[model samples]
Target: MAEKKFESDAKRNERLYVLYYIFGAMFIILLGALAYRQIFMYGYYHKKGMLQTQRRIIQPGARGDIYDRNGRLIVGNRPVFDAVVYFNDARFDFRKEYARLNKLRKQNKEPFDYSKLAIAARTNVLQSYIDEINSILKTDFVLDADFNRHFSGRQLMPLPLVKNLSISQHAILAEKLRVDNSAVQIYTDTYRYYPYADRAAHAVGYIRPEIEQVDPDIPGDDLRTFSFLGKIGKSGVEKAFEDRLAGETGAEIWVVDHNGFTFEKIESKPPRKGGSMQVSLDMELQGAIEDAFPNRKGAAVALDVKTGEILAMVSRPSYDPNTFFPTMTHAIYNDIRDRGAWLNRATQGLYPPGSTFKIITALAGIKSGVIGPDTVSYCDGYYQVGSRKFPCHNRYGHGEVNLQQAIEKSCNVFFYEHGQKMGIDSIAKTAKEMGLDSPTGIELHEESTRLTIVPTPEFKRKQGSGWSKGDTANVSIGQGDLRQTPLQMACFAASLARGETRTKPSILHDTTRKTDMKYHGAKKLDIPKSGYDAVIEGMVNAVERGTCRRAAIDGVKIAAKSGTAQVMVKGRKLTLAWMIAFAPVENPEIAAAVIVEGEEPGDASGGATAGPIMREMFAEYFKGRQVAQ
Candidate 1:
């Protein structure tokens, strides 16, 4: 039994010995393979790296210019210098390289003291080495905290230390870099700026520092890896045509040495400049209108009746677009964002139409034959319909008045009855046909308007309610839920004047290149001349001796209507004053609408607030009149 056990132990030992030898051979082979790769691969890369070292300087392309119809420069670029860092090109162990400096300060001579040194003292370090560098550089080289966060994620890209550096600063950077060629490098680029300042800010828009969109043509393979892209328009025409305005950015190959110092070459594809935009804005007329609203808070839109060109569109409480370029700090943004400023009231703001909406009631009453030109409604300060009593604007009422007289005096009682007779459905349909309750479809973004139709079964399903006559009466008189933008009012007024369904208006008269606008669905519209004529006479009387008396321009018989509409925000009632009109009664050329909010006197009417601005715009617009220029 002892001999058999010894034999089993020998066999076990032999198997263990063979397994150990095999393991040793495999380990040595793996080590040798790693060594070979370390030598061969590193050798090839290191050699090529020598021929291709560089400072990794980057260039942001120039921003495009914006021109008005008259070819005047409304927006342009100014040269700016920036303090930037090329992280990948920064030599020395950024972590440890500075470590020795701090250590040296403890005992030995400090080799490089960036912190103790003044801004100029440190401008000549890292990638560049020259005398001229110091002379031209105006900014300090110390990295900022915000920059550090960006650099970590954007290691491959150069960091901008300062943006929109002034002209004097640019001069300093250029001269210094030329003379010294120091360690710190200067990057020059164009920053977006607006010459018009606030004149057309709402239309021209602004830009941000970081690019928001990469080229849509980027390949699937590279898209995931690319970290930064170019600018995006945030609002107005700027946002609407972002693709054309953002332009393109190019890429280059960067190589570095062990020190992470840039010492090689750069090969880059040149970036494509953005396209120039010719806005349909009438600078002269825009300026004139802007001049009219020096202090008042309001907006105005003047339309070309023969064609749908917006002659002038001015949103008051204007902000300098220059504030938005490069970057808009929280403080500056908050200052302008919702301060009743920034809002393009002409195209997007919805207001109660007041007496201006009486035309629609008249049209509905006329069309439905429920009320006639000769039909009379007595307004003894108030109107009675169902369980509701509506008041007339005169307070004492016009007593007994015809449809024309009711419109002339803007009698609310008449419209309240008209709303009851026409009902909500008929009023809604007529209002829609007259260009209310829908977006004017102006080029501006998210243009808002009121819904004319009362909530139907479908609307009820969505809103969880059935239609009511009271609601109908409310909307018909441009109260309750009835709202229309200044642009919509002008468009509808133009329709009433032209008798053809011309579109509301356009920011770009020459839309040959704007593919999106090519299919906007503009078509010829046919409506009964008598229906238009009836509305026209009412508007004419409105201007001759009615609510729109403020809009009367001497030498031109203005057919205008004014409205003092009630607006409620968060259930608090306020009045939004408005006026819509067309001029040169014999041959109409201009259609104008102005809306004013926050006017004093809760009883403030559109005729009082918007009328004068419209009158002023027309006086100047047609001062040197001729057959359509």
Candidate 2:
């Protein structure tokens, strides 16, 4: 009995020994794994953890401000909130759920395409979320197709579902998102704001939404995947100085929790603000000049003759640049574009100079020795050129007239004879020297300075055509291909006032400039002072008692010339009325050019149409000067 009991004890001891060996082996394996993790594998795990919890965020800075010459704010930026969706994060959560189902389906031994099922499930989830958002915001959020496309093409970018959100809308979205911790985000952003609405709409310009990459070779850790870079300038001064106006981008380091909620800010660098712009624009005078125009399809410009400083420039039928922001409605865009409202007519509209070209022709004839100051020409209602009668503006001409009287009366016969005598080449040379064939060098991006038609023998030769007596007669009267922008005419009038060519026309204020304003190239006309006085006398006489009598002011002496040009518009004949003038002629302060387009055939001459506008502009200038004194 004792031997059997001892044997039973030994059997129990053997079982205990077997259990101890197994536990000892397990402990050694666990200790080795701990040592390996703390040593060789530590860097890999630490990197993985950091990638999950730490993130880099980019912050976009605000655009700069724009101010007029009088220090009034013309353009600025305003804070806005945008509702966006980070599709990558949403896809991550969707795939996690899909993997759980995938495991269950695999356990059940079901044959199914995992990729196809995952896509269907993700689409349904996203649609349901959009439906919820729509209910809260009371909007029809139909972004299914756009979401699919963005997910395929730009998955890292945050898709902006709604921009420029109202305060109430933002509040509701924040509250709803807080409870569910959804992948949707509300980001703080900025959009351009024009306080004066349509005032200075063309000169100030507008902005549009765009993504700008600073450097494509930058490391991924330097920027956030879904950061919102603001809109960029699309036209006007905005486009002219885009680099100086668009601010620099910044970055932030954030520590996030396991659920992707940012818990702490590790480090941050604020964005740098852009530089402001100062332009030579007087809002008050601009409004006045625009209001003085007779038609809504023409242009007007007033210049400080001595300095070539543009005091006022007005292009009719202008559109509000603010309408371009946050996406313009198709109807409004089409309407404005169709009406030619986007055209800057002050420096871009091309029209015949009419009798104003007589100024250049008279100078050419005198300079070329084809005519003297006392050269007399007969105007018996018409002039004979190759059997065709070129009728004068005055059907019953001034019988016989000299240079001064012809200019005052705008007799076509006097200019016709001189133009044929000197030919188109002489006239074109004088015109080019007087700053007529080049741009005025204004700061606007839309200024157009296409070569004006001179119709010289060389010009005709290049066109596979030849000069004829009729062509010479037409060129003399500013008809046919002769075209000039109002800005050019203003410069011409200014040059006449200063007795030299002044080509610099700037939109930047002298006071705001950091350096001296560069000299715009000029040419000295060597004509005798008596010649200038003779032409000035005729222009003054025109305003005093001739056709431009409407432009004469009570206390100011204004030298003036009026022109009526014929043009074809939409298969219909139209007349463009023009007036170029300088006030207080002896010591001119302002030189102006005004044009009213698409006037009726019998609509009073340029004197009656554009003359009053010039008179009003000059009156305002003198009134301001008087008040200032």
Candidate 3:
């Protein structure tokens, strides 16, 4: 009995010893694994933790206001609400998800268009949140094709799910998203507004969203957020003065939770607004000019003859720039662009000066010793250059005429004889001297330069042709590729008024105390004073009793010239009527140029079509000055 009990006790002791050894071995192995992980994988885990907790974002600043000369707010910002979603916060892996969707499409035997497949993958990933938003906001929204492009191109920026949200929709989204909204957010954005619509749109310019365009002027380190809301000027004064008008970007560091939700702000920097730009445009006068030529296709330019400052410039068939905001539709953009509504005719539209170029021709003839104030040319109604006979405006002939009488009557035969004698190079040299052949150095984009026909020997060679006497004859009458913008013609009229050439045409007032801010006064021309006096007398006589008699305003002495340019359109001859004038001729203060595209050849006469427009505009401009005096 003793031996049996001892055997049972020994067996039980052995079993307990085995269980202890097994447990001891397992504990040692666990400890070894724990130490290995702590030492070797420290960096990987630390980096992963940091990524989930900290975020740096950029805060975009507001752009500056734009004002007209009268302190009128031509352009400003209006607050709008936009719904945005962050790709990083959503943890969306575009490549992996795209692969998965591609596999499914292959299994389903569907066509493999990579673009469509990509869009499908994006739609699948964003569907859940979109559904939730639709339910909460009581709307039916679809992520369209633009979503694919925007996501692929600018995934670094927040994806705008909905733009310019309504008040009710915004309130509903905010209420529903308060607790579980880490990936989605509603933010305030700005929309540029032009208070006066299309008035002076060409001069004021337009703004567009900063999608993928990186400005060389902006520092890379400044913008930390991919979804920063920024805008840039596309043309006109906005683009020319971009440096002074674009705001600085700022940054903020935030501490976030594991779900990538911002819990608290770690550090922040406020953004700085851009500087305001003050221009020399007058909205009131702009409106008047636009209203005066409703439904007419042409351009007009008015300037301060004393300072060379452009006051009111108008191009007909202008469009409202507001239509380009948020997102422009294909149809709207096509309609505006295809119809040439975006063109700034005052500075970009080129046309022959017609009789207008005679002013320059007369000046050139006088300076080149080809003709003088007393150098008489007989016009038996026609002048022969080769076998072709160029007839004067008066087919019956002025019989014999001098430079002053020739300009007043716009006699083509008189210019033909002198222009042939002076030659193309001489005339071109003098035209360039008066700011005709080159750009006016305006601060606008798309300024058409070198389009005017200087018609020199070099120019003829460049055109793969030779200079001819017939070419010289056509050029003398302001025909055969003699093109000039209305703005340039306005400058010419101003120069004629001042008896000198001035290259300064500014939209900014000279308030800056810097040396560069000084007004560019007129440069005295090298022509004889007799020639200047003779031209001025002819211009005044033109407005008072000659061809431009319609431009004569009551109680105001006006010096003026009229032009009727001919062109062939659709195999038929057409005309463009033009008039240039300055008021109070003795001490001229304002100069203007107007061009009207006549529907018919005979329908367009400089004195009949364009002269009345200048007359009315001049009247409206000086409406109160005479009364007040």
Each candidate: what lDDT? 0.67, 0.78, 0.79
Clashing pairs in 2: none
- The sequence of per-residue lDDT tens digits that candidate 1 reaches over residues 213-236 is 434443322222334445556777
Cα lDDT tens digits, model 3, 1-629, are 99999999999999999889999998998888887778788877766665656666665677788888778898888878887876666655455679998899899999889988766666776776677788787888866547766665555457877778888888888878887654578978888888989888888888887742333433333333343657888987888888788777666666666644456776776777778878878777777777777376788988877767678888877878888877778888899888778888898889998999998888888888787778788988999988988878888998788888988888888899999998888888888888888878777775786576567777888989988898899898898878899999998898888778754677764455231113444467778888888888888889888989988778788889999999888987988999998877878888999998877667888999888888877887777776211
Candidate closer to the true structure by TM-score (higher is better), 1 or 2: 2
Q: Which has the better TM-score: candidate 2, or candidate 3?
A: 2
Q: How well does model 1 score by local distance difference test?
A: 0.67
Rank order by TM-score, top first?
Answer: 2, 3, 1
Q: What overall lDDT, based on C-alpha atoms, would model 3 receive against the true structure?
A: 0.79
Best by lDDT: 3
lDDT of 2 by residue, 1-629 (tens): 99999999999999999889999999999999999998879998887777777766656667899888789888898777877877656766687768877887899998899677677666766776677778889998665466666655455457777677889999999899888788778977777889877656766778877764443432346333445556678777787788888877766666766645556777776777789978777777777777777645888888877667777778877888667667788987998889888887888888888998888888888788877777899999899998899999889888999888888988889999989999888888888888788878887777777655555777777989877888888888888778888989998998888777655777766753332123657766657666778788889888988878888777788899999888887777888888899977868878889998864566646898888888888777787453211
Kindly indicate the candidate among 2 and 3 with the higher lDDT.
Answer: 3
Evaluated with TM-score, which candidate comes out highest?
2
> For every model in order, what is the number of clashing pairs?
29, 0, 4
Evaluate residue 337 in candidate 2 and report its C-alpha lDDT on the 0 to 100 scale. 88
